[model samples]
Target: MIVELKNEQFYLCRHLLNRQAHLEPISVINQTNPGRVFVDDNTNPTSGMVWLGNNDGFIFFGNPHNEKFNQYIDPFIDQFLVEEAKKVDLDYMEAIGNSKDWNTTLEKVFKKRNHGNWNQRVYTLKNYEYLDKTEPNIELEYKIQKLDNRILTSVDLTNLDTLKENILESWSTIDDFCSKGIGFCIIVDNEIASYCYSNFVAGSVHCIAIETMEKYQGNKLAQKVAHTFVKECFIHKKLPYWDCMEDNDPSVAVAERLGFKSYFRYIGFDFSF
Candidate 1:
């Protein structure tokens, strides 16, 4: 039978994650990020799954032939997962299989209910010097600001609400993000034009999420803000990670131009509620 593992016990699955130990799963296992884990055997797990705390996705790892794990998948998807997602006000669920065997198993189980299949690219920064530092040459009234309690709590700050929501997407709470996260933003006309922040973190590895206001897109503001965020990561001896859908040209371009090398590719699936 499949059994849920306590947060402290989440580390048991580390061996299964192997080379695909991205922040999402690592954060959960480290208990730095909220999430749930289940395994086919409590004492000696051979297969398992992680339900991301943010309800964003699931990670299927280990032996795909674990009968108990295989049997639990359908109900977990159709019943438990669906209910939990709705509680979070989400309309669908997403997942990734860690290995080719697991990938094929996921396809076989979720194919009919699949909403979409995405090819995701993961990047690693071997050298910090490759980050583009060329600021927008145009004259613009803007200032770079580090994210802090004041920035997170300011009620009247323009676009700050959107930033808070984005942070909450992957973080359990604003306070949690403030304490463990690092970020930088570009303010234009007293409004946040572009920002980059840690989305998921495990140990010294940080995965970043960045966004630029539509009106400010062409100003190279994203590059400017991201450059600072990355530099700060290096200053602290942290490893910055970048992951995005393969078809996300803009995101791919940003990482590539910043000198992040493609690390790995994985298949992800979206399932309907």
Candidate 2:
């Protein structure tokens, strides 16, 4: 029951998870277009899986093993994982880890011996409910040419001067999705009030961060912008996934208003400084 890495098996693992939920396959193994190592047990194509990239090893995805498989092969898989870690120089800071059984291994692999400090959070779309009656405070609008408007431009984060001058800087990540994904702004007269962007991944779409200016707080512009983005995700046949720190209440509140539910909790650990 030795598990060996293979390419087709990796794709099957990804397909299985996508069928179950909107989770993003961890970036550790899937860093390259057609990545490196992929794992499989001889008897079961997906008894367990592992993926190794340039410098890091990842247990990218896995299917649960039966009692027989667990007794016969789980130990070998564990040993294989440790050996892979050593081979790749797996530094937690530089490496990404994702697995179905992360809760069990998090402490052994991620924790500082006695300190044991870790934080995790996850959120999902709860129920699909349409806004039958719009509230007065909730303002929703759409503009096809919003990106062309000069005032709606995102604050540049590349230049040192622009980065230092602005309290909020633009995200270059969403720039690539310009015409395809939704570009929205909650405006006040000619000024940009707040903004949000949505993007598609593996047939599903999710909203990234949305923010309102500090001076415009308490006006619910953040919620408005987020709701608008969520609606767009639905239209595109992509479910919106919300990810944020557990303590980020404001962002979580907006998700709740938009009918997002908590699906799984994920904690990130960085051991290498």
Candidate 3:
């Protein structure tokens, strides 16, 4: 039997999710707002069936001890989610985890429904790029700026009406992180042309996210802005963490130029919800 988890079952959910987190730290997707968590065994969550991850994707995990848990892994994944996805018109969703059995069962789920592979890698860099100057040394045609304390912590993204609404969603997730988070960007006509910021963080591991307006690409805007963000990280005693798909040449090159090194490789799936 399946049960949708709520606050009453938070402890059990956290315990099982953390069991998965041990294998994938960044995979510890939901922390602030708990996403939908479903479990077959509320009493022994980690010992049986469960699923987790953030809104972008999910990480499904299964415990070995329960026979009922393993028996229904495929149906729990395929039939239940397929029907739910159809109900919500869930366009895209990807699920991954540390369990081979889960992956094996996931294959059957994919065959029954529809899903595809989303491959990616995790990267990190510890050697901080220290500089004598607090400000970035790089130059740009657009005004290069560091996030001010006020806007850094919180900003009315609605004020940025010119930017694509989807791109500005970072404010919702990273606002709180700004107190400790730091970032740099190039602005053109009061619009962010290219920028880099610490998107999500776990302790000293600051995950970096950067994007340049299509028109602004190829100007080395990403590199300069990211380098500036890295300098900011050092000033604040933070370690920059970088991750990208192994197939992402530009991302890999930028990280390499910024002195990021390969940390580990893990399975990543890409599919529609």
lDDT of 3 by residue, 1-273 (tens): 666666455456544443323222232334332245666766666533223232445566545344565557556656677676666456566666545455565565556555567556666656544332333344545777776554433344333443323223333444444455567767776567877876555556577778888876877788878877887777677777776777899998888777676665555555654
Q: Each model's TM-score, in the order given?
A: 0.91, 0.55, 0.72
After superposition, candidate 1 runs with Cα above 4 Å error: 132-138
Clashing pairs in 3: 91-273, 92-272, 92-273, 93-272, 93-273, 118-268, 118-269, 118-270
Against the correct fold, how does model 1 do in TM-score?
0.91
- Residue 5's lDDT in candidate 1: 92
- Candidates 1 and 2 compared: the better one by lDDT is 1
Clash tally, candidates in order: 0, 5, 8
C-alpha RMSD of candidate 2: 7.8
Cα lDDT, all candidates: 0.81, 0.47, 0.58
lDDT of 1 at 254: 82
C-alpha RMSD by candidate, in order = 2.0, 7.8, 4.7
lDDT of 1 at 215: 91
lDDT over C-alpha atoms for residue 213 of model 1:
90
